[model samples]
Target: MTTTPRIAIIGAGPAGLLCARVLQLRGIEVTVYDADTAVDSRDPGGTLDLHADSGQIALEDAGLLAAFSELARPEGQAKSRLDQHGTVLSSFVPEEGDLAAPEIDRGQLRIMLDQHVRPATVRWGHKLLSATSLGGGQHRVEFANGHSATVDLLIGADGAWSRVRPLLSEAVPQYSGVSFLDVRFDEVDRRHPGIAALVGDGHVFANDGDGRAIIAQRNSEGRVRGYLGLRTELDWAASAGVDLADTASVRRYLLAEYAGWAPELLPLITDSDGEYVNRPIHTLPAPLTWRHRPGVTLIGDAAHLMSPFGGFGANLAMLDGAELARAIAEEPSTDAAITRYESVMLPRSGELAVQANQAIARFFAPGQAPAPDHEAEHRRYQEGAAAYRR
Candidate 1:
């Protein structure tokens, strides 16, 4: 009888959960650790448009494609571009049967993946505090709650601030010089018809010549998730007295900044439902690569964290999980699996990271328009999406 390997996966996010699911299918014993107390401890944020090549393919590999299909919103694939004055610049609605990419709420995707994995596979409230090599192809992981576990293989899917990364590389994520003030409007269609019309069915991306802009998307339950982006220094936000936790204060600050902009864009800021979330964009250095170490590896944000400008972070993470799982299942030895996974993933993620950096530089630069040439930008996005699919 072949001895199954004992694997430890950090984080219960999509990458970690999907990795655990695939490994369990291969009869490997896996334990997933997450900091949250429960599956639904905190809201997992907004919706995601899972591209056919990356996110969708990863789900198919894990045997969750059908589950993802059931939860995906096809009608939410539409996109609209506008200026701050509310004039529609361009729009695209994929024809039926065009499975280019479909939108799924982040919460729904989580639930779908959660149901497919075995219960108790994930130990919640297990905040990872540190990890140390035990020598001879084993490692010890310490948790914040005075608990620890030893495993033969450790997979770090813990995301941007991962503890597992230091074991393999000395790199850290740096700010992208852009900050987003996230706002939301509930029951937008019913309560705020004008704003709802501005957003339409899918996403509304609008920008002005100035350094300020907005990207709003129609979320599940008639909620509109909007991001008011600004190109400013990292300390600029802190010095402005903009209370990130207070919605009213954020609204006031936004209005004051965009005082001369059109009123149509103001409602997205003023009529928000929840506290503003101040997201300071960060990314790993371009072409980030690490030396491979035996018995340890990384996936998802722990590997290549980049700006959302290219909208590939989650999709790439899911793909990394699937690829890593395949490597381990097919390899004859643990060391071989880690070696193959790193060899392929490093170059692939590095390419995407470079593209993400270019996108950020162009989109958020001063005096630049968000996706200046709509047709050209769409074509570029489609080409990248196609390459990933192929």
Candidate 2:
């Protein structure tokens, strides 16, 4: 008889939840723990383009592709590059019926994954505080709520600031010298017609001469999300005289910064109505690998945190979850499975981390001549198209 491992997955995000679902389907008993009080306790952030080999494959493995397709915005696969004056520089739209990396709201994706798991399989309020090895192929995990669990396997799907990472590696995420002020505009076409026209169906990228940029995306429900990118010190935001907590103040400050630029681009910041979120990008050094340890492993951002410049964070995380589950299903022992998983995952994630860091540096490179080699990117898009065709 095959032995089923008792696995504990931390974090209820896409990686962790999908890991649990995949393992359970393979006849393994899995439990998921998350810090949130409820599933919808926190906003799930912006939209993501589920990549073909990574995210889409994970969803297919979990048997959630149909539901994901229903929620995915396939028709929204368009991109535009705008100058500071809101002039369209370059624009590209996929042919109708194209399914290459269709975008999906983070909230809807989470809900779809949540519905597939059995009731009570996830303990919502269980925030992991620490983990310790108990020998005999078991580990003890302590939660913030004064609860603990002893399990044969522990998978850390927690994000960049994962509490579970310290057990395996001494590495921590380091600032990438770039910060983003997240902004949102509601009723885009109705309230901000000009901005809507600027951002069209998918995304718009506006660059300024002062090492600042604005990336805006048209999300579902006619809402638009914007990320005001600034290449500044970690504390530069405070010196900019903007109230980080107040949306209006943030909008005003952004408008002032881009005062001389295009008025059309200002609405993305000036007309934003939602709360401003501060995201200080961080990344781990390249070739981030750890020694093989029994009873514990990590996936997603916990394993390889990188800058979002390449837009591979979510896709890589989902791929990690899927690969790890596949390894566990193939091996007879937990130690063997984890070892096999890390063997393949370490090099793969390290390469991606390098690519992500390089992408960030190139984006901020002095003089904005066309971004690096489009060969790899074109290959990715083609693969995505093939997946859709399948």
Cα lDDT of model 1 by residue, 1-390, tens digit:
135677899988889988888887776768999999988889688888787767877887899988888778777778887777778877887666655567888888877777878888999999999989988778999999999988889999999999999999999999888888888788888888988988788888877766778988888888888898888888775699866666677777788888877887888888877778888888988788877777899999999999886677888888888888887888988888898888888898899889887887776665645444533544554566567656
- What does the lDDT come to for candidate 1? 0.82
- Would you estimate the TM-scores of all the predictions? 0.94, 0.94
Clashes of each: 0, 0
Evaluate model 1: give its TM-score: 0.94
Every candidate's lDDT: 0.82, 0.81
The digit string of per-residue lDDT tens for model 2 on 144-240 reads 9999989989899998889889889999999998888888888989998998888788888777645688998888998888899888888876887
- List residue ranges in candidate 2 displaced over 4 A: 369-378, 381-390
